[model samples]
Target: MILTAIVQTKAGTLVVDLPRDRIDLEMKIRSVGIERLSDQIHIIDDEEKSDISVKLFGESDIGRHLSLLFNENYTLFDVNKTMQFVANSVEDIRDDLEMNIIHDQYDTPAELVGDIERMTDEVGQYTETFYFPLVGNMEDDDDGEQYEVGNRYLRYYEYEIRELLQKEQDLDGTNMKDYFYDDDNAQKKMVSCQWDVVDRNNTLYGKVEFRLREPFTAEEKELVRSWCIGQAADGLGEGLEQRPIETEDGDLYVSMWNSGDDYFMYDEDEMNDYLAQQQGGVMTQ
Candidate 1:
């Protein structure tokens, strides 16, 4: 017989796997204080925001009783207390009752929040560059283009999530402490912003960057570039950047302000050329 228990907290989730054979089931049941633990489960999550749940396997009678706690939430404090109860209950059950932790999901809020802050900082830097040239050229109206209230862009920020593994700890197999830890294996990145001119019907652009700790290979760089392009397309609901330059890896880095004037000028020239050809060398505004 096997029993599965899961405890979820604001920080993360923990899964414990318990396996016991039929021969020792009766003896283990009597030794392990399962009844005492079940009675105490109610005391957890008094605040009404419990984050824990459990599942029991084996005979129908025990499984039915355990099902009552399934999908229910419990406070972290109560969850910890329940785990201690289980640990102590199974201490004398012997090797016949095998319990192994199969899954653990943990998050480092401080590190994750820090990553967000850094991404925001990068966005700020980009915005500063965006307004710098426009501020300088505010008075210059040599081209037909003019900046109005609707020329600014909108910005969105969100976390890019992926499967994260927790770090290994120096604890025994039976200890639940190993199941909960402030560790992360995968890098956390974000698709920071999608830029579209407020009034113009231009292609939507997106920006994705990795604050990589290790240097990537040539192929890896290309992969990151492709990922950035795809993220932008998904966010914007349009295709890739209209005027992508030829580059070794890919022209993934986007300088919105630098290209703002150029795209407008290109559009104007294309329109002018089309009109000239249509009029047989005579152009009309």
Candidate 2:
């Protein structure tokens, strides 16, 4: 018999095939590495409060047991307690059974905390131009082969800003590393955020986003606006900025304006027309 076990990691899915024979199972299990069990931790803020979560494979019976173990052993702040509990249970099994389990080795709690703190610092420093990779799977059309795909995307600073402004807390301070690194006080602080997929020419474009912080200045806002418009133009192509160019699908243009305390986004036909005029005329059909 083959016992198939699935584990999620920050990189992607990890599938383990264990034979029913105890000897073979031990041998096979011994091959498990530390890199296959981690998951990406995301922190989201909504209305001045923080929510933390991780993208991972659904739990099984063993996973549930792990959840209990984690709660008892450590504090996984801001994460879905159930998920953390399940993960911790899995770790426990790995340890007790001498099963080969893949997980990162953070020699100390401070080391784990530092890794997360660095991530938070990165999010803050690069408030604009921050990108994350969303992992998935794809099959090759020619060979019927399968492969992992990491679709990169730009995360908008606006999302975090809205979350922090409403909640008055630092979303990044959420304790993601605690659960991920198997440490205490993991749940005392957690953060949550959301991301959307982006496409270009029917192909996945790398995720990108602008990171932002509190008390945004007018200059910063304008810079973001310009950068976004430039990105749109870059994605669409040259001459897209000046005129309403029709692609195979529909008209596309960049519209920017300011409201009482924020900025707005829309497609601008006039801007496209102006661009066309600048080009001497629209592209001939």
Candidate 3:
């Protein structure tokens, strides 16, 4: 299984891929070495948060669970500094932890909270540019295989999707990662936004998709969708700070649905089909 570890530090946030057993996992993570190790492992499972980031410790996205080995607790923040990043106030967080533990919220207790500063040497939340990977059996396109996400996309817009992949060849890029960012942004604005070209009803459209990390509620999804639509066009997410987005951009409308989604399932074919049905005076199916 592919183990995705999202390591957040004082420098920058990183999304790493580590696939191995407990022993190997330990050696790989602690290759840099630390002063000491805790008596046990701990985890923060925040299924109730408004975002995809739950664990203050690294997020381990694997099919199953294993004992996590984290070290270097004595050097960093003391009780005061560490509690600053917890749920609410330090007092409230203590109560919350106690209640959550009694309610079976935390998967494992790990070492006691006396050991502050888990995982990496530095720790803090980066509100900007949150990184989370699309997990599960998503196969590479080269093998001509489609998993749950791709198969759903293929059901309706496979024809248009096939054409897009072919166009990707002449496009200059060493790999797919090149096209997965908004180049206009000075800093690397990736994972948050990505776009591609598609042919729909003979008109070229930008197939744009947005990501809403997790605890995906209806409001959060719409907020991200609207924001991406505003940016879908040529640097004008609102459609004209530099360019008009949505209708003006190749895409008719901006949209997003990840987290509890199969990547995204909408495509040009579905749009055309809806338009056709509307034109026929039949309600868009």
Candidate 4:
């Protein structure tokens, strides 16, 4: 199913296409801060149609980098520009995938690439980074490739820890973005990250409740709030509805060491216990 919407503003005209069947057109209309067009927008049934006309508008330099206001502090520059950045990010993902495939072992590079593509099939927002500690002093070869013989850490063995997670995503019906990266090396532990994408599939909306651990830093508090915006972006595309929750508890935080539907809170005692359980359970490093 293809849904097309024609949008016009003081700057210019924009033609948008949603290739998904289950699309909330009303939500999308409101996302552009143009709720009045909700009723005026039209969608054509093009399932049987072989070809469709797509109108392309000329780029306007006026608001090419304009700040799209989605509530306060939840601003996006431009979708077209952002997509370019996302394209660049794909190269980075490929580079990391190549590095891991060359240094770590499991299957062919094609298989790993296919797995990554499948994992990131959705257009939702998420980012991940891999880490492997350097066990010995590193030296570059003639081809400029860094290699170490004796050290397991220098050989990029940390990625092997995620073999179970890869299987879970491939067979256990787990969401790829939700897969946790576990590492035994303390130096490599701090390099994992997963951003929560707010979608109808995961977000609790206003039902979200915060249970934060105490003695947290200001940075940790901000990180929790940042994820909220990210979750909104995942759900509402480029728009956001920032609703700050007042918590009497201490600062909120997110850790890469754990995995859950809700990742924006801290509990020192409970977290240590949860980590122990996770380590002891299925996902071990």
Candidate No. with top lDDT: 3
- TM-score of decoy 3: 0.22
C-alpha lDDT of residue 246 in model 2: 29
Span of 10 residues, lowest total lDDT, candidate 3: 127-136
TM-score of decoy 1: 0.22
**Rank list by TM-score:** 1, 3, 4, 2
Candidate 3 residue-wise lDDT, 1-285, digit = tens: 223444332334334343323344344434534222211222223334212221333233211222122222321112112222231212313454445434444342233232221211112222122111121123344563524333233334434443443333212212222333433231132222334444333333345433222223444434444444434323322222221122111321122223453233333355556447536734332
Q: Can you tell me which runs of candidate 2 are displaced by over 4 Å? A: 1-118, 121-209, 236-285
Could you say which candidate leads in TM-score?
1
lDDT of 2 by residue, 26-96 (tens): 34323443221121222222213322222223244433222222221232222233232223222213352
Q: What Cα-based lDDT does every candidate model obtain?
A: 0.29, 0.30, 0.31, 0.29
TM-score of model number 2: 0.19
lDDT of 3 at 132: 16
69-128 per-residue lDDT for model 4 (tens digits): 111211111222222222222332555543543454323323443445543433223222
Worst 10 residues of 1 by lDDT: 161-170
Please provide, for model 1 over 129-160, each residue's C-alpha lDDT reduced to its tens digit, 9 standing for 90 to 100.
Answer: 01011111121134524232112222111111
Instruction: For model 2, give the RMSD to the true fold.
Output: 19.4
Instruction: Please report, as a residue range, the 10-residue window in candidate 4 with the lowest summed lDDT.
Output: 67-76
Off by over 4 Å in 4: 1-88, 93-192, 195-285
TM agreement with the true structure for every prediction: 0.22, 0.19, 0.22, 0.21
The predicted structure with the larger lDDT, 1 or 2, is 2
